[model samples]
Target: MMNGHFDTDNPDKVIHKGEYENSFDNMREIALAPNTHKFVLNFWTEDLKIELERIRTLDITDNLTKIKYVCNVRPYYYFQFSDPDGNIIEVTGKYTPKEGQFV
Candidate 1:
């Protein structure tokens, strides 16, 4: 699919939309090269607990061993897991910081 960037994940009826399209919608898409290496992907959300619980409910999901915070400089809550092929996927939530602490 990488040669012409074919739509392997999408349904047959739908094709990719570029910036010039009028009926465009915001949706997540992945660009991958045909290689043996795995990848890491991160996303942000308003609630970390909700997303964490959602992942927990999936019987086949695996929890990652990474830290609970995105960085040592700030308190960005996050969680990570691996796909079946071992590509890492992360989801994080941002909290308001006050007095160098987050709620």
Candidate 2:
């Protein structure tokens, strides 16, 4: 039986009972690679507005690049941009990433 908080019909929510430990143990000491990457802390609600100030596009590609605007509890927007490393940066928005996608 699953906890009432989750729908019992959902397979992802189904788990064998009594398998969880009272307190979880940390296994971080042995298996992870030595720290070489800088860590960034994301504060979900702490004035994240500035992070989506502008959308910058580079080395334009044929694939579709656009932001999906979602308005619910918060009016959030998405901005998609390509970096010099060819990595796509998706920033939550107040505006769309591509000019054509905007009004």
Report the Cα RMSD per candidate.
14.2, 14.2
Q: Least accurate stretch of 10 residues (summed lDDT) in model 1?
A: 17-26
lDDT of each: 0.47, 0.33
**lDDT of predicted model 2:** 0.33
**Tens digits of per-residue lDDT for model 1 on 1-103?**
1221233335353442212211111122334434432245778888766666667776556544322543223335556666787666767775333443322
- Candidate 1 local accuracy as lDDT? 0.47
Report the C-alpha lDDT of model 2 over 37-83, residue by residue, as the tens digit. 11212223222234433222333533223434433334555433444
**How well does each candidate superpose onto the true structure, as a TM-score?**
0.46, 0.26
Off by over 4 Å in 2: 1-64, 70-75, 95-103
lDDT of 2 at 23: 15
Instruction: Report the error of model 2 at residue 92, Å.
Output: 2.3
User: In lDDT terms, which candidate is top?
Assistant: 1
